[model samples]
Target: MDAYWSPLCTACEGLESGSVLVTPVSERPFEIEATRDDRIVVKFRDSGEERPLHREQFSVLVDRLEGSPITLETLAPGVEPYAAVLSLGPEFVSDGEALSLALDEAVGGESPHLLTPEEARTRPERVHDDAVLLADLLDRVDADDPSSLDTGTLTDLYVLLSDVQRGADRVRGTARNSLLERLGPDQQLHGRFGTVRRTTRERRYSKDDEIIFDALDEHDVPREWVLGVDPEKLDVVLAVTDLDEDDVYDVDEQVYVQKTGVDEGEKFSRLQGLAERLEEVEGGEAIQEDLLEIERRIDEALASG
Candidate 1:
């Protein structure tokens, strides 16, 4: 039976010259030869120790040359003696375009070389869906009057909103890092939070709270109502009075503020809501079906093992 060989095949690595490499096309093993010429001649190794393969039994290995730094001179010669050079056809050229074409064929095509837009789209579906939903929920909160929302509703919203924001941060961080690694540092940065800071009264309150208080007081009543912040695009500012001190804060009554822009906060909130909905949906029968299928596959694999 003819053997198959692929450079990328794990079995092909570290193969010595003159070693028999199988071609999947012909299912016959050919003796490898390293040549000083531009081409390496693949032939049947007829050592008395092993059965001598007939001429019809072996197929020639032809590689088109390109401008690749690799040349036949660099190939290590195998154990086979020089045989009459068999002319297959016109000489293969190593021009840039031809070389590229050869490489493309050797690797089985350029399709795997680059991702289609559809594949790229699938890559971000989970993250993008979460972002959109969070952005929508945030917009709803921004439009509503904080005073109109009751404490229970506010707490629930805050909890949901916070969860979404954190989730978004996690996804964005992972996706951004992945892109950066693949595309290099020159590409645009991908995450919502450009910078993050831990909120501390001591750090933000300045030497004189009176001076900072006065500055804030100059703003309108609604603006003055803002208390606490966590920085960046999320810029979470809350109507300090709306929070139930006992429920929202710890025993110390210390609540960390997220400083994010109003627009960004709105966007984040919508995305958060969407993510929550997706999780809820995923908890249903559809996801269970997927789990069942996975279980079935695992069971089948175990049985085979």
Candidate 2:
């Protein structure tokens, strides 16, 4: 198969330039190119015979790939004028030549099942189960048979998979939080704070996190202690810790720290741990002054309070 740039449209007038891909379907290869108006032009690869199809002079290709991975249907003449490949997986096969070439190059090197033009359009409900449909699409790709799909379907599949992954992450997070609440009161699991923005220039702490840090400063909590706390939610993350020796307590509601720093360290050890933990947080490096500056600021905040 070969493809190149071509502006030849002798059979049609006033057509725009487009790309062309040549491939063989059965006996001969054909040149298929797109026009500026989004129409297709076909020509024999060897004989240079051109056939410009009218908009409705082609066939509709209904891709029922879920069940028959290697099969496609061709609409009967007069039913649809144009030929189109729709579904997910690969680029459209322009003509019979390309289709045949795809079959030849298919995974098993076997011909694809070309259904009758009358059987072209298959009902979606009639497709095999979801698993089978997905498997078929994957299998066809593995076999190097991409002519079964169009660009739109491929994008749709990509979006669907992305959504599924995000949904799964949310579910896992919920389950993990439930398990952590049962891990006892004295546990200090190391974790990081959330982010307000992802961009480097715009990244900052959430408003609630800002307020929590401010409250910690007002209560004279050490900077090291304030930076190392993590909570499942903002509302419950500000409670006093044993590290805060000011004897502070909430009479009605206690702060819930899902994770906190360890107490088995000297002042320097605690400062180092907090610095390391901060680096683990997203936007940690840019969150505050430099580490040396932060150390100095910590002492200043402590002395001033």
Candidate 3:
């Protein structure tokens, strides 16, 4: 019948490192700290002995509350740990109090479920699902505006995806769909929401010719050109020459394609057009540029051409 009884008060034990200690007294939480001697200490406001309590007593105290909320606090220095006061709803208040007292009086018993730092860090499958979802979202956004993506937005998306990949599963599907919708083309064969895809075709020219033609095709004027040693190895390369004269001069591969260029913009518009035509293409396989490989191939073609 005592309002405050230490007999039923159970001490929650955590690792010698700072950990939350749930007590039965008024739902107040406490932290477990380690003494210099390596003994665990739980600091509580209610006056009693400051000695370490056995693990059994702690388990009993926690079990009595069931799912009730308790308040957690740190009484002494060096015992600062994250503690929460779990509030027991009205229905469980009396029962929770009784269990708390009983636990204080209980002798030795098994400890309640407590997670170590390592255990708490275990990666769940849900985390991976979140990652996949995030990646999909990034792809979608990239499809819409590759240059528009800033590091901050990418970081935010990465964090969300990482969280989902870590544990949040429900958001995965939504993230994935959002991404696909962003990447797909609109009815006009232009990307939805101002997004565009670029296309490029390469041709070969031996000298100052009237019109550069696809040496590979021998017929059509290629939208772009690649210089190579032989027709078979005519890899795609970007060529920029003085508009006044037809002198073909080698330029830095990176400089050839400006980030913002009329030619590049037109090429992306053309790609969007092609995408609309290939709507029926199945299995996700199509002519895709390996951006890195594309650059390498272009460089090789320029060096050889």
Candidate 4:
């Protein structure tokens, strides 16, 4: 299977240039050199050869990923995916490659499934019921510290929510387009589920910055008050004036944690089962080995939590 990339990945992460992209089948890698306004430049890792793709080629890719995570070969007869890989951002590029590779494999007909009538009928209902249960779980957690949750359980919730969110976005996007077809400009449709209104949103912006600034000047508006300080310009000012930064700006720095990886759910499930079994034991004491293993798992869970 070949890894693929899409501009849609940008919607998930903030992307910039110099991201690494690898070809799965060839085991060849490319480095993103620059992401300019009009085009993207990717350099071959070994050859030092650069390939530039125009922005229009990327537009074709933006919407393709949600339907099919594809490489250039499968995307179209002639297309781009390495170029699109830039969208995955530096942080998630490796993750995107593995994910897109799996998707590309499935798109190529690996372990494909055709749902049974029973499955087709019951699957959505089962999801809805599970959603209801999850909502109840969250409602209870909301009043308490969610941090009190075991890391494995928190990870499970994260995975579940991610899947549900993706499914919802896909379903709602399609339905929204379908509903749009039946409505007119400025028309409103009120239904039991929700009310939707279609209208043109107009925004006004200045095309000529100098002229706009002059107009503001004529209107007695201070240009500095009208516009924000450019950080680069502010840097020059600070250097020349030796101004105290604390007087000009309020500094705020925050500490946070982020997920780096996930362990297999099956392993966590088995650990949970073992813990439950220990809780249900007839005697006050359990085997030293079993208790030690459970304690180890608990320590690991908290370390990541």
Give the Cα lDDT of each candidate: 0.37, 0.36, 0.37, 0.49
Error of 2 at 74 (Å): 9.4
lDDT of 3 by residue, 25-95 (tens): 33333444433232235465344335564434434445644554342232223211211211111121222
Instruction: Rank by lDDT, highest first.
Output: 4, 1, 3, 2
lDDT winner between 3 and 4, please give it: 4
Question: Which one wins on TM-score?
Answer: 4
**Model 1 agreement with the true structure over 189-228: per-residue lDDT tens digits:** 4334242222224544454656667777776344346555
- Model 2: weakest 10-residue lDDT segment is 1-10
Write down the TM-score of every candidate. Answer: 0.21, 0.18, 0.18, 0.34
Residue 239 in model 1: shift from native, Å?
Answer: 39
lDDT of 3 at 50: 57
Superposed model 1: Cα runs more than 4 Å off: 1-144, 185-253, 257-305
Better of 2 and 3 by lDDT: 3
Q: How well is each residue in 1-305 modelled by candidate 4, as lDDT tens digits?
A: 01223333332133322334545445345655666655667676568888876666665554455455554333331243343353353222223233232333223311111122223223333334333333434444542566888886676566544444444455456767998899998789987535678766699986688998989889999888868767898878888997988877789989965556544344334444544655687752444354445434432333233
Q: How many residue pairs clash in each candidate at the backbone level?
A: 32, 8, 30, 0
Q: Give the Cα-based TM-score of candidate 2 against the true structure.
A: 0.18
In order of TM-score, best first, we have 4, 1, 3, 2
